[model samples]
Target: MMRTRFAPSPNGPLHLGHAYAALVAHDTARARGGSFALRIEDIDGERSRAELVEEFLLDLQWLGLEWDGAPIFQSHRLPGYAAAGERLKAMDVLYPCNCTRAEIAAAATKFGPDGPVYPGTCRNRHVDPTGAAWRLDTGRAMALTGPLEWVDEIAGRRDATPMIFGDVVLLRKDLPASYHLAATLDDAADGVTLVTRGMDLFPASHIHRLLQALLDLPVPTWLHHPLLVEPDGRKLAKRRGSPSLGDCRRAGEDGRAIATALREGRFPAGISLSQGIHQTP
Candidate 1:
């Protein structure tokens, strides 16, 4: 059976951007006769709030986006993330570094293209004796020898390659799991075959695809829908306060009106969404 999820971080109120994404995910899974899962990505413990989490759930429900199963919280899955990290660490694919933001900035200025990109300066040597964070080793360019190809339901044929993202951090010393690690692991755990997300996440697909390889997990078929952009061409942020579905509901905006307004104001060209976008098996 096909399964998909809309994983959103509960750092703030659910704005129009959240509404659009939820609608897309719900509509997609329903049209496909698949299971829809709600995945709460409150990975950032410091920033994520329970109040915001409740609001997110209520907002998604208000937007008419119901799910088939109970929600999965990444914050609660620390052991899973840690286990995955251990597996990679044992393979000598990860190393520790003590570089801070300021130090990394300075290094970026001194180093070139991929050089500034973490540089793996701390990979071979102990740059800092203490306060080190873990990093993925990309010193020797990661190569994947396989017929790696997945059909994107929206964008079509995405030929995945390991060299695309090189090495990516699965966990931080401070945080249990990074976004890439938790997300990929959750998909594997939930048996999610279809992944529906915003276009902004497309570039990061390479990283997740690589994680799937390293962990021997099934790579979920991707569908990168267009982001909910504003008139100024900037993507909607929670701070913008464009009014969430719940907010609009309180303000007397019917579901039909909200949908029509979004189609008219935010998305022109009538938004050709995938009712049942099939992927190549």
Candidate 2:
């Protein structure tokens, strides 16, 4: 059975971009006689707002998106993440690093899709596990997994080259798991077969594919759709003060009508679709 999910963090309001992504996941599942699931990525205790979770549920309901069951919260799956981390440790592909942002910025000589790639300062050092993040030794991991590939609905088959991101973090010092670790596990746990998300996150599939290979998890196809952006080509984000679904709902706007307009590619004035990755500014 085909299953899709729209996993969103509850750190901010759900903007138009989020609505489009949700609709893409929901419509795709419904069209194929599949199930659509929602996952609340609220593990970041410092940033995730408890109030926003309810608001997000209300927003999705207002948009007429009925998920298969109650939303799965990442916070409830810490022990699973911890167990996964230990498995990776047994594989000897995980290493602890205490590098601060300032330290990495000063030492990093290369930049990846996300930001300054880690210079592997702690790769050879035995850092204290206390308050240290666990980073995947991508080179070592690739050596173990060999070459890998994943299928995308739009991009077709592509080789998995996770090295571009360098050694990515699987577990954070403050959080039990990073986005890559938690999301990949949660999707597999929910039996999601199609991972629908924005094009901006297309690069992340490389890492996720590698994780699947290491963890012996089931692989899923992906659909990286274009994002709704501002006239300036910047993706609509909550931090950018983009108009949110809540704002629209409170203004007496019809959620279904808005969804229909989005499905028809008829965005509101000043909002457009961006096919490429845009820097959040």
Candidate 3:
């Protein structure tokens, strides 16, 4: 049986974009007679709020989406991430990186898909494994995996090009794992068959594919749907003042009606779908 998941971070209240993604994931699995799971990606360390997790659950319940089994929290899976990192460390493909964001930005000359690629300043430097962030040596990793590809239900087949993000971080100094490492590992661990997410994450799939190859994990198909955008052509984001689902609910808007509209591709006033795939920063 196919399994899918709707993983959300509890750093803030759920928004319209999140609702759209969750509904799509839930409905898609149901349409396939498959199982749908909800995962709390609270891997953001101190930034993730416990209260927001309850709000997220309530919002999903209001939308009439039900998930199978108990939700998995990333915070509770630290040991698994550590084990995966240890495997990578044993493979000698992982290297400790101590460079800060500003330092890399200042040193990087050319831009790649995921912003200015890391200049590999600390690529050769040795540091305490537990104290420094670990980065995948993209060049060596590509050489190890050779040519690879993953299929998207919408975008079709894509060549794996993780190097576009340069040597991406797998584990952080303060956190047990980076998004790239944890999400990929968890998807495989949960036996997710289809990954439904926004088009903005299309590029990140390349890295995930590579991780699957390196970790010897199961590969899942992808579906990168268009993002919910405003009239100004900007994607809805909390930082940009996008209203939360709670805000809409408090104003007496019917949650079921909103969910139905989203499923039908109808959006609120000034909100539409964006077709562009975005670069991760």
Q: RMSD, each candidate, Å?
A: 4.8, 2.4, 1.9
Off by over 4 Å in 3: 128-130, 278-281
Output the number of the TM-score-best candidate. Answer: 2
How many angstroms is residue 117 displaced in model 1 relative to the true structure, after the best TM-score fit? 2.4
The lDDT leader among the candidates is 2
For model 1, residues 149-236, the per-residue Cα lDDT tens digits are: 6657767787665344434556676778888788889999988898888776665676677678767998789887777666665667
- Candidate 2 per-residue lDDT, tens place, 1-281, comes to 89999999999999999999999999999999999999999998789999998888888889898999888888999999999999999999999999999999999999988899999999999799888999999999999999999989988888998988899999998888999999999999999999999998888999999999999999999999999989888899999999999999989999989999999999999999887742211
How good is model 3 by TM-score? 0.96
For model 2, give the 10-residue run with minimal summed lDDT: 272-281
User: What's the residue-level lDDT of 233 in candidate 2?
Assistant: 85
| Candidate 1 collision pairs | none
Model 1, runs deviating above 4 Å: 109-116, 127-130, 139-141, 144-147, 161-166, 260-281
Collision pairs in model 3: none
By summed lDDT, which 10 consecutive residues of candidate 3 come out lowest?
Answer: 272-281
Instruction: Estimate every model's Cα lDDT from 0 to 1.
Output: 0.70, 0.93, 0.90
Model 2 backbone overlap count? 0
* TM-score for all models, in order of appearance: 0.84, 0.97, 0.96
